[model samples]
Target chain A: MLWTVMPLEAVLDGSDSYEPEYFDVPWNDGGRLIVEKLNMDSARVVRLISGNANDYLDASIQPGTIIQYAPKNQASKQ
Target chain B: MTLSPRQRRSSSARRVRTTPHPALQEQPKTHTQEKEKGQDVLQNIQQLGQTNIPQQLSENGIHTITIIGQIEGHITLPPQNKTTKYEHIIPQLVAIEQNPKIQGLLVILNTVGGDVEAGLAIAEMIDTLTKPSVTLVLGGGHSIGVPIAVSSDYSFITETATMTIHPIRLTGLVIGVPQTYEYLDKMQDRVIKFVTSHSRITKEKFRQVMFCTNQLARDIGTVMVGKDAVDDGLIDEVGGLGQAIAKLQSLIKARESKGGSTDALDSDAP
Candidate 1:
């Protein structure tokens, strides 16, 4: 249910626009997932909707479903 | 005998001409310009220093993909274990293929090998990428890592590096029956086919190394060190980072001259 919207630069070419906001989806167990392992089968999903940080994705994501996202690109800011 | 005043003056002038004042012997303007430019280049490189994850080398139109530690697959390894998760890499590869800025890929591998299917998945991705790629194996690229090392357009290994070619291994619950053996055999054949077709080594030679019983003290495989890998045609060359970078640059240059975007070649690819 947690979908990571990849930065445009990574998913596309020639566009320099920045995404202002990204919806954060909370885990069902309330346990934070490791960002590195977010791409494993347990963390992968075909598609997802980004919602507010406090919004629960339990209803949207079926049990045993996994979702993953690309980490926000912070290199440009530095 | 004391020389005359004229003679002394002339000799002193000759000495001055022969060895000019150290301060006046400043290096040529171009040399100083180059030195300053070198500093600028060094600064740019330093600014792009190694991050926790892979990044693009925009100037060279190349991106680096580091496959370190173990290739973790579906299972989540413990936090203490150093692993390169396949899911993380698959998306990155797709992005690299889509992004026009990325003209080539440089794969830096130093893995001990993990899940066989995961390793092969990453390897297959590299093999199919249209952008030219080069793999540099440092430390050890063992077991399933062998297929990955040879999957690139060109491969390199450091002087002290080693590679172990062994048959596929399975852990956890195994039925230990004839059907299990058949499944393992089919998977092993897939790996063998990929490695032999992509690399200079023949299927027979690779199988010889993979099934060798005498190489390891208590294992079934052959260990190739540096040039030994090149000799066996498993790796393209016995080289390190510099060589790997140079090869990638050359490939990028070649691709540009041929008027083919990295992906264009992929359409006509084998």
Candidate 2:
């Protein structure tokens, strides 16, 4: 995931900002995908394979979806 | 094994007419008092730990809509029940999120909790809703209600509210060996994972409470008093809606003031 520090003014339209959800496709182009964990600025873009976003949106994926990586807690360690 | 739950201690008929408490007890024959009385109950929940109730929102130049019901699953649970109706509430939450005048949501919960998938779905909607959401546990918000309790921007529970944090269960099932136990273990992990992720509890403490052997008569979990819940960091606050709303306002203002999101980044979609 890409981690970048951008101001809130960049990504948010004040009225049009959408919280991270399963509908959004990862726009990662291999190098390193930016994970804007706290960027309220502009919408941080993640590179995805072509048509990934559309397919992800059309697919009935549940919200609050996650990609668990490193062990942040004990249960995850296993 | 599609087994029914142990016969409910309550009567079957009593379960059928599960009407909203206010609507059942007092119907506002007078148009003036109807809205006023509803507002009063909302205020009481809001000011639970306090002495006085606030005046009507109309007088204060605010408009509000309070959705008070149990969100069980697909099945229409007994009225007064709190099953997360994913289909019904998912859209309602979406609507509420989009409503501009609806400044905040005061979600008062009195639920036994139901369907993990459904329960978490409701909690997720509440969590993601653009409008501020505040959840208060009145009598009990147990089982899956735990997640809904914490889903709010801020949370509160009555001094008497009780919460049961048991491991997940799929009511009657066919299993004879350790494999069944293994499946249960894995299912419980998912519940714990969600609970800990949404609340202040760490995975270790959440597991301890979920599997706390010393607490229940026939279960593998701990029941928490409102105060105990806050002390253990399972819930955010221990007062009723008053504290809950105050906390929610603070959170909303905090977010509104500085547009910072505390979203954790993950990839595998739920």
lDDT tens digits, residue span B42-94, model 2 = 43333222211113322421223222233335443332231234553565455
Assess the local accuracy of residue B145 in candidate 1 as a C-alpha lDDT between 0 and 100: 81
- Top candidate on TM-score is 1
Residue B76 in model 1: shift from native, Å? 0.9
Q: Poorest 10 consecutive residues of model 1 chain B by lDDT?
A: B7-16
Error of 1 at B101 (Å): 1.1
User: In model 1, what is the error at residue B22, expressed in angstroms?
Assistant: 69
**Poorest stretch of ten by lDDT in candidate 1 chain A:** A1-10
- Per-model TM-score on C-alpha atoms: 0.63, 0.54
Candidate 2 residue spans exceeding 4 A from truth: A1-78, B1-70, B76-84, B177-179, B259-270
Can you write out model 1's per-residue Cα lDDT over B1-270, one digit (the tens) per residue? 222322111000001122312222221122136564454334333322323223234566777877776666765443233456676577667767767667888888888777778888889999998888999999888777888899999999998999988777555478979999998888889889998998899999999998899888756888899999999999999999999989998988898788788556557778
Chain A TM-scores of all predicted models? 0.25, 0.20
Q: Give the per-residue lDDT digits (tens) of candidate 1, residues A1-78.
A: 000111212322221221111123333344222111121111211112222222111212211122223234369659
Among these predicted structures, which one has the highest lDDT? Answer: 1
